[model samples]
Target: MGIYGALSSAVTGLRAQAHSLENISGNIANSQTVGYKRMETSFIDLIPDAPLKSQVPGAVLAQSRATNNLQGDIQTSANETYIALNSTGFFVVEPKVGQSDGNSVFAGSNYFTRRGDFEIDKDGLLVNGAGYYLKGLPIDPGTGNISGSVPEVIKLSNAFLPANATTTINYQANLPQLPKTAAYNSTVYNSELLKIDDFVGGSTTASVTGGDVLVGTNPALAPAGPLTAGTSMTIEVNGAPVVFDFYNGGTYSGSGVGIDLSGGKVLDDVLAEMQTGLRNFGGGAAASATVGLNGAGNLEITLGSDYYGTFEVSGAAGVDMGIATGTASSEPTRPDLTTISADKADAFVANSVSGGAITVYASNGAPVNVQMRWAKVDSAAAGGTDMWQMFYLSDSAATGGAPAWTNIGQDYEFGSNGSLVPPGVPTATINNLTVNGVLIGDVELKHETNGVSQFADVNGTVTVSTLNQTGYGAGEFLSVAITDSGRVVATYSNGERIEMAQVVTAQFNGINSLKRLDGGVYQTTSESGEPIFDLSGSGIIGGALESSNTDISDEFTKLIITQQAYSAGTRIVSTADEMLQEALNMVR
Candidate 1:
């Protein structure tokens, strides 16, 4: 049949040059990753017998279409959890229970991903190093909402406490003038003289008695020599020593001549012994004595040593006793001797009776009273004195009772109350994330169905489920970011950073009717149509990363056209085995 139709058209050009050199070695092995996106390989031609144009030639090697617009080149990573999606997003990931198998879950239904390298598991679950589970919106441990189902476990909450330290002060008062003394001792008198009588008459009248006399006299009063008429007589001052029945109002009955009534009773018994010696003579013996006044106003003493003679005079008629002896300038002067001084040597010279009471003492001997208010001895005011004005009795209304000296102000402050303990463990949030390179995505195919044979629908039997699960720990991979509502944030190494998964783009009304599977994955066939997810990278870009659509110069020009079509299909089976070996060697 033309040598098997020329070896089936050179094995379809060596399987399209080994699928264009495996997509030019996956676009030079991801050309430095970071959101990589360079994919291309597309071809379509397999029309053998069209409805009415059949010249009957065979050629069928169809469908390849991947050219999803290759874009890759973003690189900025000072890692605030490294992100990169200027437009479009995907990352959804949930179907976990024992990762994939089982008719690939009938090929569809929600397991999309663009790897955003997430992390957080030690129960704070936002997982991804193939530990999957990043699906979003179920936040509410207090309203961080989005709405249910992707949470296999991510809980964090509790931390914030620290603040306190400041307060201290104290003070006291009492000090003014402060000094005093006085306890008891009085007995003063040098001349000690005290006598007053402006004029006193027995049965008589003579009034104009205005007198002033203050005397501590006997500084030996000297001035004697006047009033010597009949040596002054007339003293009947009889209050009880009476026996003088001399009824001679004016006629002393001539006693000096013959009326000497027994010498007038011995001169009234020597004038009653000289008036008892001038009343015990003590003002220096009554100032050198000399006195006379008799006619019964008895008091006739001639004692300048008894005046050189015998004397007898009695009832001699001339009764005028008005005793008088003034002239020392009328005496009055004495009160000068007050000495008490102190300005601290334990000052206290007591006797301030103008409103008493004073105690004061505190160099820690505590005893304050001070209450004087008016005391003056001011001997011409230069400390010969007792000047007082004092005040301070405590109940502190600012030095309390009588506090005026400009109200005493200067000193204050006081306060207290404190206690609380138990602030122990907390300190681990370090290094805080920093990746800076290699982060390509777009390889998320997931499937899990085991209902009839059990990879895990449990009762529906068909088993397999245990691929030794358990990964994602060495500070697990987390960096993925992008939110302004097109969600997909991740970030954990303790500094948390949330919003895990919302991105879901997947559109196909006809990406050449989809289907190419083995790893650069794609599926939806039946003339591809029903996939429309939303976050517009226009329905297909999802945080993008397609890469490897191979074009190393069109795969090295299809590897030189598949090595000349595998050397022309081995020369068409060696020219059909050389024409059947010459017709079987001429029929032998």
Candidate 2:
């Protein structure tokens, strides 16, 4: 019985070693297979029943343990759709069962694999190199979001993408502070008819007589005497001080004032000296203050068209100077450019202009060049409020319409600092705008409150920082690419990149328990837990492939060990047979 038991144990060893050899052979054969996981054979010793102190060594059993958690080397592949997994998750796929109604039907059960060498077949199905179809969630074209939670087989179509109507335009630009135009004359202080500067010099008070203000006798008196020669007076105009000095008989009266108003200065001479002094003071004087005779034959000094403050008198002789008391308050005003007729578009375009041009798409996939012109109609008052009219020119309008330039019926008013003032509404909506028979829908213009501006610029140029529209024309399918988040993006001929679908991954608790199928695919079993589907956050490697996890050197070494063990097992069987034959001979 002991000899027989030894023989049976050696036979079990032979079978176990043969099973190990089969695993090694398969590993060596599939060393270059894509997404292939190496199978490792584990041996267990089966001890026979015996006494408490006597333990009997028995047969061996072989069990296969899959290295499913081990990662494979990622390699680059020429195919664009080929993807590789760098982590523990597997790609959810489906196998084609049969044909139904001339369409490829898929099996109801779900399959998972690391093999991602996928290519579009004739039926637009993304089939992997292992003949399994990839499953993913479809994305909605309108909302650019995933449609549903349940995933289906991803199928691509080469259909034409429809044209989208223009809706919102993100516009940001800097309108020239002082735009250059044909009607713009730098020499002319006030070019516009009803500009703010034109109404700035208005006076509502009566003037003062110089004879009443200058009561001191005109004589050669002491240099430091009051209201006599060498007497100085300071007058403040628009917060700027101007000094006037009386000289002694055509010579400097040793006064500190820089002007030489000698030889009995008249009212005009006093006014001229004050003007020169004011011009040289207060940052070189942006405006001029002058003394002129009004219709009442009274002497009055008017502030400069650019100055916007009251006048005051200071210094030695300011006590007797009645000029500060002879003034009235005035408010700044601007012309309404919107009241102008619609036919004034050509005039506005030709006269006042600083414009920007951009290419926009039409409904029928045609390109339209839109030329926008901002005409500065009225200059700003003391508060920097300037008025500008908006006008547009298109190729279709120029050729077919009666007017070459079309007024958009909009006004942009800028503050003194070149910042755009907010209109009554937040956004400006243009509705039903047709260009070359292509009707554009309601397009909203976004200015960001102060995006458009008008300020002082030496060159008078308007710069557009950004201009983008939401709509796109009809597009033809170009190609498809996958993103890092497992999203499949399809690019088009019209420069539109659309998200078509998102690939999902599946993870299991017992990955080793998965049943291996043909073509590197795995099926779920009761031992393997239910797969958890992940729509996003899967580390998907695009344009690459996963290589086999099997190592050739290790497989070869295992093969050698398996061969030696199998040979030894055969020798044991022969030895057992000889032992039995010797026993039989003794019995004979």
- Each candidate: how many clashes? 32, 2
- Error of model 2, residue 506, in angstroms: 1.3
The C-alpha RMSD of each candidate to the native structure, in angstroms, is 39.7, 7.2
Best by lDDT: 2
208-300 per-residue lDDT for model 2 (tens digits):
233244334332231222345555666554455556766565656443355544544465555555666655562212255555444443445
Tens-digit lDDT track for model 1 on 481-530? 54535455555553445554444455555654455433233456678655
Off by over 4 Å in 2: 171-240, 243-331, 336-357, 371-442, 445-467
CA lDDT, candidate 1, residue 67? 42
- In order, the Cα lDDT scores of the candidates are 0.32, 0.68
Candidate 1 lDDT (Cα, 0 to 1): 0.32
